[model samples]
Target: MSHALNILKEVFGYPAFRGQQANVIEHLVDGKDCLVLMPTGGGKSLCYQIPALMRKGVAIVVSPLISLMQNQVAALNEAGVDAAVLNSALPVEEAQIVEQKLLAGYYDLLYVAPERLLTKRFLDLIAQIPLALFAIDEAHCVSQWGHDFRPEYRQLNVLHTRFPEVPRIALTATADAVTREEIIERLVLHDAEIFLSSFDRPNINYQIVDKINSKQQLLSFIQHEHLHDAGIVYCLSRKKTEDIAAWLNTHGITALPYHAGMSPHQRALNQEKFLREESIVMVATVAFGMGIDKPDVRFVAHLDMPKSIEGYYQETGRAGRDGQKASAWMVYGLNDVIQQRRMIEESEAQTQFKQIATKKLEAMLALCETNSCRRAYLLDYFGEPVAFTACGNCDICLNPPDSWDATIAVQKALSCVYRTGQQFGAGHLIDILRGNQTIRVVDWEHDRISTFGIGKDLPVKGWRAIFRQLIALGLLTTDSDSYGALCLTEASRAVLKGQKKIFLRQQPEHKKYLHKKQLANDCPILDQGAQQLLDQLRNWRTETARKHGVPAYVIFHDTTLMELVRMNPQTKDELLRVTGVGAHKLDKYGDHLIEILRIA
Candidate 1:
């Protein structure tokens, strides 16, 4: 029983430590370095936060996003911790005041952006203060191989050089073995203990569908599964983000667009609105969602395939952070695959890097096309094996995809590519197989090929699926020299000569679940009495948050408010027993809550 555990219970209001939190905290409190690979909402902040409080002085947190710092500092202050952030967003006078206070030892924790932390002026200022530890959040950004690489983060090795006496902790929600090694090497945490929590997010239902009427499909998903919930819809381009946001708004959903193209003020305002309000969907490119700490995001949908599995995992990890039932829905097609391949080939990265990028793209495709347990495949990608056979929560486990022996169809598709001299891409090959009388097919004389019109029994999408699976299976390769022309690989010869068999998933029918008046019964629901109290509590919270100019979650998370409603505590002592009601919060809101509970 250490003081850290006591602080966790008294300040954070959690009765016990989850998973390896206590171990990580103990290691850090012992003045040692650590690399923590916990899930998004697995209490990574607590590991360093508790140790910082229990140790000598201020804990400096290096974060990538200003919003992340603001959100975290606000939450810490709400929990009765003296925390502040230093970033360019602060005015000159305000920054001077904060600097003076920081020098006077008035703050327990200080959050700063990487660029600001690396400044000579800030470094000199920190030298005068007794420091507790250095917490490098979103540590994967230090690796070039990571999806969200920040070059500024690479310079963080200066921390080890400058503050040799202070301990450091690097934390990330997403990182594979390769990225993990890179974080340790780049951050110079060679002797740090590594804590790799399970990456399994069972509360999020994984659903990947082949693209068909993508906008309609997205609308259907929103209208049915995640209606009236806060979520994020990721797009590939800036223009697409704006278009989709507008479309969603036209259909009676409050939506906003966020991308690098937007002005800084506009992006900040939109993000603030999303965090403060409910049922607002943010349509954005990868420019958003690095350190968004919003806990109530109910879903994350992707209209395009991510460049790699790491990117997909990190993006989807944003949802269900509050441990609520959420959805990770995506729609991809062969076009997305081709476009991603083209982008990779056109990049200026070195040849070896290009090869690595191509392999990652193929891995993402495999996850999409996998008919087995999606969670198992995903966890296996990160080098973690689960004991269970099936996750029972993903789309694949709920409705097993149909598979057909496509030995003959695959051979026909490969032969068509070979006969076309491997000069045509999937479109021309599909045209040749489906006997499309397109001018390109006619000019190439592919209509007279032996494989021509032999696959008319299958539709164009079906043939495309076979070719994509062939590519994924390594039976076919894309020739970048010829602008993505299809080429038969050595493995294709066995399938063509009847020595090998191929299986392909039958194209699933695009079925949309009907919009029910409410979500699934299994999800957290309120009875009529509790619902009335919840409504009143939400109204009070919104007003309180507005007056204080902080996000509603800072005042109290929706989960805490719901607990108040369910318990219907009529007395101040009873209200203190509710979860999330620590001494500070209980004193702040106990009377108000008890009054509302009694009136309801």
Candidate 2:
């Protein structure tokens, strides 16, 4: 344990271990298997990294994405650690050289994707060398029902079967009780210890808004709060990602599109640009962020609804990774709900898969419509219930919405569905209720129904919210044919018969987000001269990173720079005292940093 602490300070440059990091590292060093469920940026890598450096031979890390592996390996190299990655992205000669180094015991850590790890040739080669430990990242991918399911991950049970003596650790950022169990079962870690950290990201402010002209709403949010910040915008479809990216770019936002539809070269190029540059928005689908380790993402906005709470949590978790203030902003509407349900109904997955997926989606909808604390609901969903009802960080706690007695509105909507023969979509029904004599309504003689014009007092947008809530509350469902036609569910009977009352949440008027909130990461503790020093230090870091062919944050995180400006360390010894300055980093960049601080 003492030696581990020394390494944490000497190699990793952290003064102390956070939460269960120390315990997890000690357990792995003791040659025991375990499963870790730490949040993103909670120091999960150090659990195995310290053990890998202290243990006998080499640690084999099974990752899902080659880009992720490259990022980690590059950061490790910058930290003066011997790390290498073997993936299809490498040239044949480079791969062969890495393999040769592995045989010669040259690297302390080697990262490989599951597909490459399970290859017989690679497995056979590892068998001939001394093994240290096996670390599986993004272990939620092993669950068959997980959001990011990869079939190859299910085959990782062989690690324990082949190398029974080696300690193995499976790590993930998001998983429910069911998915968690599946991870343990699939990874064959029944006897392993479990370390579950709190899933709450206190640094993130949760905000959900009505989808009123989604593109414009998104533009407004970004323009007001994150115009000059780095963020991610997630779309539901490939074409939407591209369209949104193009739209944002035209609006003067430095945005790029990323999805599976793009060619490998283009995708890589866009991703590289996002990583290398600052103040860029990445418009992407769910495929873009599994292994992204970028820590400066100020926000993650969902333009459409995700398939499940797990997916929502995973995607939103990418923000505020550096423990800075970030936002998880979303705009969902009736179409997003219908679209998610229709996709599930249309999928080729089996009955049980669909059932669980439906339940998960319901939870997500309830979360969106809830007038209570959003953060508490999120934490409770993962079985980490908080004692407090209001977290004060989410929009609900900041500005509570009103829950109107919507029973009459709901009854009117349900009756209209019944009188219209339950074959019409919400748009047509809303039109008929608002007394719009549309050609289709007139052609069908729908304007003559008693329910027609009944809801004239309510605006179109108001009715849209009520119907959206009804569908979300399971009082209504789409037709089995995957059409947009609204059909009353069995649960709708009570409301239609006036036996049960309904209360629907009404979105509060847009609160003008303050300009200070826009720069949540801005450090007020630093005066004008100190702020100038920070900028100069950033310029130096950027040049150094460019020379090293790595991202600026890889050289020193923004948080570290803030600390440097505050501390103003003058000597090499004083510089080493600051956080994130390990021995190797101190030796490599300490002189430059000292000079920068000295001049100030």
Candidate 3:
């Protein structure tokens, strides 16, 4: 057997490694340092995991998230591996126990937070162990230029200085060229093979909707898209997280809130509930989903714009980790752009950091507003070449967007912005277009202009689209603090006074897929009778999974139960023939299936 295959089957219970994991593992196992860039669900863990399992001594993994450390340690224990974690959550005696185990070489893997590793006592204890390799997860945090940066990561260079003989591996699911260079320099990876995997997750369906009653849109999406499946809803603030979580629960969806503000126990309980599939959604700020090892998350919804495309990609990639079909849906508005910019402008980062953040925000905005394939743009940002024009999975790909000659409309919007002295945002501009005699307009005496009501032919939504497209096209600028005030760009001179013709796609009213009917023939077993049986089976499965603290599928797959309901199989032999029902599972679960089928 190949070395990777052996590790996969024996250690990970798989037959093969996915994507570029095998190549990465080989480089690390050969005593070479590596810088690996893979997508979230792209099997990044195994790149270091398999190599760690194969190495001579216990591998020390430096991770940024303490919760993730506990999760990984639990997962490793379930896989029958000797693993332990060092964090503040443990009591002194428990921590001492783990330390003693480390000294006795009792663990095959040790996961530690970067901050925890920097302590003098921990470093002294680590010195006594026969170290195999050093693995740094979320290595992007080492770079000050990267999102999610930790000041403690820069101190990680002491690993190289202190343990010169140990091979090191740094891994992150998101990083651009600038962040990549910073990670290498900050981590002191002077000689490391860089293994970059393709960033495309073809199984994910990408969709972006205009921010219209965003709460309703999110609820509608959760209800209709994949009802009650495990998912995440990322809000940009703590208040939004709490409100959204409460709203979802009141609407009958089991959702929880997670943020750094919550007590550690509460956060742990919520995270544990989500991982155990007792909760269907986790409404969170940026404090969720890093180093989450859960594999069956079915969707990720963003109620606000992320700061960068890399952040968006990494956040969305958390869905569909099992390679099953999933979705990445986002709701964004002009204010999101300004809010993000304001955050960067207020930060203590250098000028280069500000520029990079601004450019990344623009790239993300372009991706959202582009009439082109969303997947293609995302892949291109990760430095992957894409010859395929349309991926047929995203909203833009499935239904072609409509383009309109908006030369007159762009001219009207720009003329209004310029005539109004660039002091208003899209709302006032839209009101002006729709001929609303609001007090702001009368106070500014803007009603006398000829271009004031010329845009009356376009609806408010249409005019908003124009303004968004104008910002994206660089024909307009938004004030960072005042939340999307419309200001003219240099390109505005060309379009405002008819010096140059402008073209813009009409903003779509509702995405076409939202109108699509459920497939008629996909699952014929969803009829009334079968549905009744399915519900009973679901209850049974949920109880069983809860009792065992595993995902529902671990108890019984939906497909298997659906088939049994459809076939109404009365015997073990008949039940065994259904898809996903192996002999052992049939033997264990056969009687339960028969009991449910008898009632059906």
Candidate 4:
């Protein structure tokens, strides 16, 4: 234990382990298998890292992306640890040298993609070396049920069969019960202990608003609050990413587009800019942020709704990773709901898969439309207990929306769907209810239907909200055979028969909570001189990062810099006492930091 604490201070420069990090590390160091569920920036890496250093042989860390491994290896090397990567990104000679060094026991940790790790030649090489442990990062990818599934991850149980005595630890920032079950089954970790932490990021403020002029609303959000702040804006399609990026750039915000459709080189370049530079927004689809190491992202904005609560939680978890204040802002509307359903209906996956996906999508919609505490609902979805119903941190808790009895309105909508031959999508139905005789409605003579104009008292947006709630409530479903036509489900029968009452939440107006309160997560603790000093240090970091060709956060995280600004360390001893400033790092950069502090 003394050895572990000494390494924690001298090697990693942390004063103590956070939450359950020490317990996890001790279990792993004792040659036991375990599974860890901690949120992003919760120090999951240290759970495996210290064990890797303390154990007898090299730790083989399984990662899903080359970029993730590269960044981690860079950071570990900066910490003066002996880390190497074995992936296709390496040149042939370099790969051979890594293999040679592996056999010679020169490396304490090795990062490899799952594909390369599962190869027979690699397994054969491992047989000749003394095994320490296997660290599987992003372990949720092993679940076929996960949004980011990798087929190669399913075959990783071979590690257990081949090296029965090696300790294993699977770590992920997001996973529900189902995904966790699949990961354990697939990874053959039935005997492993489970260490579950609270899946909550208190510093991240969650906000979802009705989508009226998404582009303009997004512009207002950035201009009003997050101007000159680094953030990410996620779109649902490749074209939307491009469109949004171009539009934002034209609006005087520096933005870049990234999707799978872009060329690899262009995508890499954009990603590099987003990481190395400050205040650049990356408009991308879901392809951009699995293992992103940047810890200073001020916001994560979504222009579209993700398909599942897991996906939403994981994406929003990216913000405020430095444990400072950040916002998870999104705009959702009826179109977002329809688009998600249409996607699920159109997928070529099996019926069971579609069923599960639809269920997940329904849960996501519930999150979007809930009037209760967003944080509590999200925590409940992950089976975590929430002591309070209202977290006072989300949009709903801050500005509670009014709810009205929508029973009669819901019945009228269902009757319209039934009378319209169940072949019309939301637009035509909405137009019919609000008494708009579009060409198609008039061509079908549907204006003569009994339910036509029955909902004339409601506005178009109000009717749209009701229909969205109906679909979310399972009272109405999109027919898979037709072109996203609304159809009444078995659950709809209860509402139409007056056996069930429906209530819908109104689209709450943007109360300008952020602007009114000026809720900058990173602002409260900073004064004028401290802010300038932080900026100076950031400028120095950017120059140093550019010279090393690595992300600036890799040198020192924003939280560590904030500590420096707070502590104002003047000597090597004082600087070394700061979190994330290890003995090795102090040896490398302490004198320069002290000189800066002295001058300031």
**Steric clashes per prediction:** 0, 0, 0, 1
Candidate 1 colliding pairs: none
**Comparing 2 and 3 by TM-score, which wins?**
2
Alpha carbon deviation, residue 394, candidate 2 (Å): 0.7
Structural RMSD, model 1: 1.6
Error of 3 at 486 (Å): 1.9
Instruction: Give the distance in Å from residue 335's predicted Cα in candidate 3 to where it truly belongs.
Output: 2.2
Cα RMSD of all models vs. native, in order, equals: 1.6, 1.2, 4.4, 1.4
Q: Write the per-residue lDDT of candidate 3 for residues 1-600, one digit (tens) a residue.
A: 297676566545454667778888888888889999988878777777777778888999999888788777765655556889998888999999998888998998999988899999889888988888999999988877666889999999999999988999999989988889989898889688999888889888899988978998998887887676899999999999999999998999999999989998999888888887643799999889887767678789999999888888888988877666788999987777667767887778889888888888889889988888999999888789998999978888877688877887777788888777788888888877778899998888777766677788887777777777787788887775566577887777867667788767656667534522332222263668778988898888888667757556555555556667778889987875675565445555679878878977
Report the C-alpha displacement of residue 498, candidate 3, in angstroms. Answer: 2.9
lDDT-wise, the better of 3 and 4 is 4
| Candidate 1 colliding pairs, count | 0
| Candidate 2 residue-wise lDDT at 566 | 89
lDDT for 236 (candidate 4): 94
Ranking by TM-score: 2, 4, 1, 3
Winner on lDDT (1 vs 2): 2
TM-scores, all models, native as reference: 0.97, 0.98, 0.88, 0.98
Best by lDDT: 2
lDDT of 4 by residue, 104-194 (tens): 9999999999999999999999999998899999999988778999999999999999999999999999999999999999999999999
Which structure among the candidates has the greatest TM-score? 2
